[model samples]
Target: MLQSDVPIRVHANWRPLDPGVLGSAGPATYSRNFAGAPLTNTWYPIALANRIAGSDLAPNSVDINCNFSSVFNNWYFGTDGNPPVNQYDLMSVVLHELGHGLGFTGTMTVNNNGVGSWGGGTAFPVAYDRFGVNGSGQQLVSTSLFPNPSIALGQQLTSGTLFFNGTAARIANGGASPRIYAPSPFDPGSSFAHLDEATFPKGNPNSLMTPQIGTNEAIHSPGAIGMGVLQDLGWTFTTAMMADDSDGEKVGCCGTGKSAMMQDLKMPDAEQARLVDAAVELTKASVDQDDPKFYEQLSQSLMQLKQARSESIPVEPVNDAEESRRVFQPMRLRTTTPETERISVADDPVWRDNFIKWLSLPRRDRLRIWGGAPVLAGEFEHCVAVGGGGRFCCTGTLVAPRVVITAAHCFHLGCIGSRGEVYFGLNSNNPGTGRVVACKCVPHPDYKLSTDEHDIAVLILDQPVTDVAPCPIATPSQIDDAFFLRLAGFGLTETGRSGRKMQVEVVVASNNCSSSSHQSTFGCKRDREIVAGGNGLDSCNGDSGGPAYVDVGGRFLLAGATSRAAANSQRGCGDGGIYVRIDKELEWIESVVAAEGLSIACDSEDESEEQSNSGSVKKE
Candidate 1:
């Protein structure tokens, strides 16, 4: 609780963001050219503004998309140092995001050409910007030293050396100014808003506000410099010598693996929020909620959405998914598309460098609908989210202690080496909150990107995983045209959310082209592929490289791997999905395990005997 005459009211919500952005906050309301003050349009994050104004100013104060942590990757909720590596502290990230909402940002920014500017390029510095200065004590905002926005000012922004000139903060910093982040080429989201990471490295009391966080890192308090900066920004303490940092994440940095640069987009405040939301809304089937209150809200939103024509809303097409050369890249032209079909961006591969492009679309009214339901906690343990090389996109399943099976297309042309980390978890609600295991991946020799033929890969883990049992592989004889498959993935759904594990059952719509019922000329018969399309049940983004299972008795056997949306489908997901017939590739799968000098997963004599003696194959 804050000791204010009124109170600080903050409004925040959970929504999917780009891979790295954790959360974002800032002024919901800005005062332009104030009559009395030092700076014009000095922006204040909503939290601070609320404390002074004594009322909530906007619909929501902060927009947090730590959705990656809840159900996705390995983010440590504990402040203790037990998980020594790859753990991104959840509380630390929240505090950092909250810190921005509470005014830990500056107005300084540099363009691609290294020209610096402040006050949103209009001489209107943020409230925090008033105290900024260079290492030599020259105020960056002072007209006497530099123009409002100039190459000279830009040089100072990326000089790798800048500081906050706040008196209290300087005093807290041992009489020297508090350093700020000013890298060249200016990381637009991180440059001026955060403290310099090096000068106040992750163990310092002032590191909570830094621009990048490494894995396994956590900060429990906001540090001394944070309070000092707040003090300099007009916040008063009842009795202050140094001030209390009961404002948590106290020090510089906590723990982590690699330095990851993350920033939440300023919400409701940026002009781009709606556009981003529109982009997100176009990709799903519908919204869902298990909680009563949220469900009720969603029910209302659904009705309102049903009455409105979605085509009325203009969406700026963003080619975020232009890459990855999606296997189902063949799009059904609109002229022939049924009017009932909703737009789907599921086939788009645009998940990278997209945080800033996201606009604040309504969190509740989004056009998300999932044909699948959330799986119970303990089920589908073998399913995983696969990411590496700075891209957090596909999904995979554990087939053995050290082997993961996913789509060959998930990786680049040649699986020359280990691709990236394999995440072991059911959902990803925060930025990084899943148990991670490193692995080396090799795609099938016959895999073809052009026709998506033989789309399969065997990812061999660097070490064995003992906690989760691998999914048993089905023998070639067990699969046929009469197939009912279980689809599981940590991918996007109708709720405008991804990274959560969802399960759906779909029937084999078509297998061989010769018997008629062949879905499309785009090749249902192309390269031993199996087709499964449901009206609203199928896999989408983040589910690539995932497994499709078939039941034999009470056990589910791995029968296929998620390849892409059906080439003939109207929407990306929910209409249908293509799967690589894994039963046909059993020989190749074992060959990879044996060649890698690792014992094959789930092919042991005991398991085979247990299965052979078990009941006959059953369909769902």
Candidate 2:
């Protein structure tokens, strides 16, 4: 339940006890940042990277595990608990564990045999491991000085004097490197991974992450140095988030809390058991019915029921020529034929450029959003063209053989004639080649035309597309760990108009309205959209409704769908734009597909494809 540049999803569960652990959480997977760019390779927590791509990319970014057994049950759920003495604050522990999962622990590990290695056996170090140094400021991971997997690195791990070299963290620690908890004994889980406990004693502002929790203590926020390290990790906070550490001396996030009473009291095991039992009883005590906040948070579960209008099925009505005038006989057959013809005049970039200017990028810098590399032949076949007679108004992704996901804005009569044509393959010149006519369009119930919130729609296709394997809709976890967004579409190119599909990688700007780059300048609300792009790369004219993908391992997952130029983009393409975070629309998508007589159950064969030619696409 945290967000930085984008929406972040972390699900928590009460699980059986793991010995000597109260709670634990970390990224489910990790990956190399990118290829053919920049510095030495760096690994990123896959779930954190997905946050930059789209929301709800998978079920959750970090799977949280907390002990809930009777043996580990002496806990206070919130600050208002009675007789809170001897009780551990669950919120404080949760915050501390979340801090680590978000990005704290590293790959460095020390073996008992006087040897140490980083990367957890990977080829590159994680982003956090890059800033570590020894007592004399020697880089721990560098082969030039401290060769990896050597006695030198091991000595540094147990040196009792390691420092974080990040400039931001140093500044936060009073212009000096923060002392790390590298004890002589070298505990694998604690050594070299935390702030020295003595330096920031219990209740110190930066003690929340000191590797230990104390009874009767609660940290209100991540202390100053914690924010600094996260800043060094490339996370930017809003003004309010930054304001948490302004006072400095508070016993909050990243700081120590109340001293360990049990550690000092030396009570007998029987006495400790009695105290634990009392704490458990406290949890079961009745709540104060008059507590307004309690009642507010305890709102009853709700279920909304509505009757939908019966729409026309697969057959397009020839009831009126104007309404069905654009209907083609392809709807009458289950198969299509390819031809050696150019794209239709309506969709031809060259033809459209003669008058209309934008597609995803606005026409005036208004419509489809870019100048990017042309896709390889037969690549991204599931990213189809949406419109008729080979003339397309927007782009879409095939989620199922008979289901296509597109922007709600593209569901109008003028845009795609309500029931429009869908074309597959790189060239849509011949409507016969893999063209699947759409029979119905279903827009989100809460879709807002004025704000573009929930700017998504579903199109039920007339026939199944067997050749092109559909993309798997991303889950919340996948979205949070995405490092980049692959914008792919049959859009306008720099040469004015090429029917070939184009794509470019856009950096995620913000995932929510509050942090949107254009929030102040344009009052742009990315509430329904995810902001991404910049540096001369973007989805542009004719790229509307395109698929924005995230590569999970080697498989490309559908993270979002191109909607329009970002609310803040004055130039449309390069300045960055917005895309519909398709992940958040999973429920509506499943419902629509089900209503249309399509079976797209998440874990079913509909989401699976052969791995030989097309990249793998899975729901998980």
Candidate 3:
């Protein structure tokens, strides 16, 4: 178990102990520092990245130096020239310790997760016997190891397999599941394997409970090795979640008596033989308890018991609504066509004054700090409408070039021809009076309407209006609740009153919506009700497709869209109209534009210039 504050110790005598050539890793020699002292208050691995320098006497073993220093609080090894011990040996030792700490003891095999028969198994064994063999002495690999096999706890012995990656290996000793790792492949002739524990987190590829290779030259954790030794000794360690007063180290419940588990086992040959006997008994007991036939029989018995325990099928009581409703037929629409044709825009009274007012300069001074138009280079001005519904909504300004950028959602609600014609540069009262530039609406595909998230849209007009050019669009930014917002839309001026009218209000409202659970600020559940009833400042039905602007550092940010009307709302919308939170869906918005071959909102170009200039517009 890992301690929060205590330092684990490594002995001073540590040195490089690899038997094989550096193999894939080159022969790198490092200067030694701590040679005579035992490392204290620090953890060390059984195998390390450090190298052992050979002395004149012995070519096999090398000495490590542990320089006592108050700076580090104890002796430690590093490959850097300053460290005393041979860095390579220290790395190996640490690796060994990590294994024991992660729990790799007993007869469990990591490959198939089967118990290995023991002639004599050490804490970190050199080989495996878990693979059952045929009568002719041929090795029969366990069936569980195959991927997508019928049996659970499959075995995998191949090296470089992601199942035994190093990162996943480190997740032992109570770590989260599905750990990703890159495993080190085993060298040729190495027969070690890993063990998997049934209790380990699901989808975790490497588990010490599973068997793994034991290379004397490989890097392994010494602490893990020590822990395994203790387990083999018949002592179990229980980690403590609470703090401990003594030593301040995390407390753990372990054996306390003199005659602890495996206390009688001797070392050398006698110890090996005793361990083998214990392994056989354990394996026999496990096999007897969990034979495959026993499980199949148990499952069948349980099924039968469930069937026998079922109660008599009950009859549903008769309900008047069910009988009456079942026989009820829906009313059909009658075909009575005798209506006068509606007047078109061409026949309507021409209102140039209203158009001039709509095209008047927006209240830039009252805009949100992070929102509104910024100055652009050259002569053209741009106009941007931020709040729009669905995916084709967003804000942009017309620079010298006639361009209008409202959100993609504004145009996304209905398909082209099916949707209402877009009218821009109109005054707050008469939005349709502005110079009508028949629009080409384009919406991003990734935009989803489920949560009203990622609502961005763009519009292209037939020509640009030179008199009232679009304002330059600001860059996207993150805005918190502290940001103030403003809104402008041709939505209903009041709740529940939907009509062909536009309302522009520079109200200082909170940037964040009230409650996200409802999908919109106005969406109330059956059990819950919003308290804002009398406030006249609520979003209404007509506000469904408008921009909510946030002020960030003098920039006008398109923060949200009016999305949902209050639940149980009358035909005419009422208080607590909801708006789509815009900041949360920026990435999706950008992706839609990039993937659609459309230029960014801030790009300097306008295809609508010709249409915008066609109608002669006088400045307000």
Candidate 4:
């Protein structure tokens, strides 16, 4: 039932650990401690659950150790109800193991001779140790033999006398207490870590969290007793109650109340209002018919609310100094074409004062060009050539230190040769001086060659580039027709192919460009593609995958990436072309960056700063 935009990273590669050293399928550890401070509120349990779902912390790392021996090869990996009798259900095993990662297992570590400790002698106890007791009904932490509370509980677990003494668990298990597994000869990974295998045997209704798995068995739910144990150990449920009415009073399992969960989330006013209305409607439906589906709907609403809240949190660039340098300082404007107005610039006082000071470059260093006009020396530093063998096949923008955002067709066109190299700061025509080989190129999963629905791909570099700063991506609300964008790339121009990078100011014609051939060959999606061109300015070949950037408060934010040229343009490359909107792919971009452990520079300044610094330039 847990849902969120953030992905829980799973590392499933084969490890060569001896089976005798680690007995279970895997082990789970918390990346960060949720034991104290702000984490101790009534809504702590729900917030913890959400944190586990979206955590980027190292302590949240869960390692699943698998024995890849030939004996385990016959495992059934499908979801069908019927399988071969000899096949083991891999899904059920994985579900149980994931439960351990989600706070089912204890954090205590014990030695061979029954000596125990936790948190490296700090003796900190997790929620699980609070309910543990000895055979004589003495609470483990209250025992006199051990002065330290964590050691006392660890000794109890090592002694094989620990049992869950919570009233909820006892009532759920038919009046018998649930015992923790602890045999005479202590097992490091197996002992003190699981439910008593004898009491909750495999194939038993409550055997999902037990130590062993039997043949042809499937556990769909974590039975009534299992839920009780989890509830006792500081875990909250989305349902109205943890057990039957007789066990305890119905509690608000989402948090202390719905209001608390809402307080934790920061969403737009419109989205928050909509979610509130949906929750109210679902609550009324559940009150009327008691349908289980209502619970799921409510859960999804909460998840969506949480996701909106996370996305609303603004990201800031790592280096504010570098970000300030990339801001385009307007000088003078000129009407380049009947439909185009260019923001013309020369090596003026403002450029020398700002550009030279920021980049620490020699004042005498003159701007150079291949076949186009001179560009601001540092304005398009984030632009790079994404091809191999010192050739500029296609252009890309570095949104992250190690990630390059580009057009999917760049790869489809075979422009990105094998062992592709990403040339950064290729200001001159020469591409040899600065280049990094790409480690992987991941196209959008839904990218279609025929229609180009999601014409985007992310290239991960072998290492991060340190010379140039990355550009910030625009939000969906930021891409309007009122603003003109600068299209920069090392692509072909009116004369011929440009060895150096060039840029031109162009206005957005129509967000949705339509034609008979374009409609038939590629579906026109206004929200995902921006049609912009005017005054003999357009993105041509070799420009595929380059950036269409808008100057927002001096910062060059990426609004779109070059997708394709419109088919019906009479001027060929002069008319407006299609650029994949970056805002539409923000979520996918963030997810991929998080999964790949890449750092993207974001604008972290407050809204007031962005508003006060907004500058105006001539419209195209």
Q: Score every model by TM-score.
A: 0.41, 0.39, 0.27, 0.37
Span of 10 residues, lowest total lDDT, candidate 1 = 311-320
lDDT of 3 by residue, 259-341 (tens): 00000001123433543454334323434322444322322222122211101100011112211211111110011111232
Residue 455 error, candidate 3, Å: 3.4
Which is superior by lDDT, 3 or 4? 4
Task: Give candidate 3 misplaced runs (Cα > 4 Å).
Answer: 1-420, 427-432, 446-451, 465-478, 495-534, 552-557, 566-574, 581-620
Candidate 4 residue-wise lDDT, 1-620, digit = tens: 54333444443322111111111232222222333322222212222343533533333332322222121345677876344676556666666655554445543455455565433222234444445567887754443654553445556666766787665677777776788777665544455556777888756788777765544766767777777766654445666234544645432121110011000101123533654676546534525223434433432332232212111110111112222222211100111122232111111122222221322322222111111333446678888767654555677898776888987776766666434778776442443445555646777877766667678888888887766777766654556532456788876543232445777555454443333224421223656777555324467667778898866666677888987665434443554566788767766766777688654544443243432233211111
**Rank ordering of all candidates by lDDT, starting from the highest:** 1, 2, 4, 3
lDDT of 2 by residue, 1-620 (tens): 24444445555544322123345444433433333112334554444444433433333223222222223457787755232777777777677767665566566667778887776534566666777888778777787787778888888888888887766677688878788778776664455667777787668989877766666777757787877776665455664233234446221122111000000101223544554455444433467644433222221000000001000000100111222223211100011112332111122222222211112222121112243245557778888877764466577888888888887777642456567778777655334445556556777777655545666888888777777777876655566565457778866543233345666655565343543333333223444456565434567756677798876765777888876664444443455557766656776777777676564423222223322112223322
What digit string (tens of lDDT, one per residue) describes model 1 on residues 160-232? 7788766667668887778887777676657766878778776787888887666656676777787777766
Candidate 4 error regions (>4 Å) = 1-371, 427-429, 513-517, 520-523, 606-620
Give the winner by lDDT: 2 or 4. Answer: 2
Off by over 4 Å in 2: 1-5, 16-20, 35-40, 51-70, 80-83, 240-620
Looking at candidate 2, the ten consecutive residues that score lowest on lDDT are 300-309
- The weakest ten consecutive residues by lDDT in model 4 span 257-266
lDDT leader: 1
Model 2 TM-score, 2 decimals? 0.39
